[model samples]
Target: MKITFPHMGNAHIAIKALLAGLKLEVIPPPPITKRTMELGIKHSPEFACLPLKISVGSFIEALEQGADTVLMAGGWGPCRFGYYAQVERDILKDLGYSFRMVVLEAPDFKLSELLNQIKDLSQKVTTLEAVQATRFAWFKLNAVDRLEFCLAKMLPRVINKEEVLAIYRQALQEIDQVTTRPQVNQVTNKSTAEMEQLQQHDQPLLRLGLVGEIYTILEPACNYDIAEQLGRMNVEVYRSVYISDWVNDHLLGGLVKPSNRREILTSSRPYLNYFVGGHGRETVGNAVKLARQHYDGIIQIGPLTCMPEIVAQSVLGEVGEKEGIPVMTMYFDEHAGATGIQTRLEAFVDMLQRRKKSNQVWEQGEQLNAHVPGC
Candidate 1:
């Protein structure tokens, strides 16, 4: 079967590696772009979340490129994500596209079913081969996450930001071409070292935490590359979610230990105690975590009309007030513009800088007064 899947940040890279290793003819969807968004918007429900539209557009693109089957992840929660695969299937069918849809349901509670699905997809491969292929893809996933983490840490500090990004793109390309553990490790290490060599300023900058729906948080096209924009503005950006962490905690049954969900749920208790759907709880939890860690601010991005993120956004205001942390919520759709987002980001950064300086001065004054007299 000629297989294809939706793009989510570096996910396509690992997915390409996995399907190819299974000896399948993999048709990688074209990168999300204006045209893709247009195609999705024209055909999707007016009120559907942004991710659904983009993914539908992506699937259509892949199908046009001769992909006979579409592989998408399924969810089982209050979030609308759980319904994506079936909805996209019907939408594509109505559009008169002839293709098969495969939904890989959340495997945490259905390992055997998930394994069977995998085996069926890898038709001619042995069990051992399938296991090896999965392991290789897992390593690639971890490598991509590590490379991204390094880029986030180095982006704001680099003297020439473009140079760091150039190396990063090249490193991603190199990593994408590899199929073995050692090769993934070699490229990741080389990329990290190259990033480390970029000239950096020693002074600290405003630190911002990003928390939101997973797709919007990770996909640049979806969020207009907000993290890079923040980095360019001399702000340090930290995301609450990563592909590897999500896969490990949810799909792998917490094999890595110290469950991300546990930590998030515990921290979110003061604001939201139960799962409201999507990453709403996690967003609140992460915001609380970042607040306690003394981050300058937090930005929450999600698709317009997304229930979970909306719930999180409502609670975040109270959290921000209580914790004395600034919070900004951004909703994206086809109508969202980069220029507008940049303007807001600039204003937020300016506010944080002013607050930081004010606090510093106030502390200094208090110290001086204490040393001068008992009063």
Candidate 2:
């Protein structure tokens, strides 16, 4: 059986390498595009997470490429992500597609359970082999995400916009071929060292932490590649969610949202127990951490109907107000506009710069309706 995972961002490299190293056959669907979103919107539930729809479209595309098995992460919570795999699978089956889906569910705390899910998710793969695959998958995911973080931190210094993407592409390609930890570290270190050499300056550019739902924040096709766009505009950005984050969230009870109490209390041993649900609370904590480190601003991105992010939206607003930081909130969907997003981003970045100079910040609890329909 051939396995395929949905595309999220510039993460295909490390993830692909993990599969390759494990000798598991896997494929990634094409990047989200106008046609991909169109198909997703046409077939999926109107209120579904934009990522889920894009993922469905991605799976269908992969199936066309001779992939018969799909792998997806599973969850359980107030968030809709918990039910995404089952729903998407049913949708695919109803569309007359013949394929097997492997969903790794949360609420199973044991490492053994996770390994079991890995086995189950990789249809036709043996349990022992699946355990090995999980380790490889983790290595690939951590490597890719850390590389992204390093690149993001360096983007503000990249004078040429095209060069940044070129370097990014190069790193992605190199990572896809990596096997051992030393190889992964060497690849990342070299890529980041080059980026730093190219992006050196006396003063850093505006640093913004991006927090929100998993898809709209990570998938460029869905959010119009906002992070790349932000990087081009000379804003250093950090993303909130990742494949590993989801894995940890499900495995560790939940992604703590500090806005909630029980989660924080239950998380005594863990330093980040305050993060209650999703990246909303964690986003705030990260922003506070970044702000204390002297970052310029925080950007809170979310889907319109997503309750966790909605909770994040409000709490982050309060956080921004109290901390005297400039925060930009944008809600995205199928109807989101590129031009508008860029324009608001420009304005926000400009505002952040001005606020830094004047020692002033956005009014407490101010709301910007960067909202679009169908989110």
TM-score of candidate 2 to 2 decimals: 0.82
Kindly list the per-residue Cα lDDT of model 2 for residues 68-105, writing each as its tens digit: 88878776656788788899999989998899887766
Q: Per-candidate RMSD vs. true structure?
A: 1.4, 9.0
Candidate 1 per-residue lDDT over residues 1-375, each given as its tens digit: 889999999988988988887888999999898889999999899999989999999999999999999999888889989899999999999999999998876566645555667778867998877777777888898889998999999999988999999999999999999877888899999989999998988767889999999999989989999999999888899999998877766566566435668888899987899989888999999999999999999999999999999999999999999999999999998888778988999999999999999999999999998899554
For model 1, what is the C-alpha lDDT against the true structure?
0.89
**Candidate 1 segments exceeding 4 Å error:** 110-112, 256-258, 373-375
**Backbone steric clashes in candidate 2, count:** 6
Score candidate 2 by lDDT: 0.70
Where is model 1 poorest over a 10-residue stretch in terms of lDDT?
249-258
- Scored by CA lDDT, what does every candidate get? 0.89, 0.70
Winning model by TM-score:
1
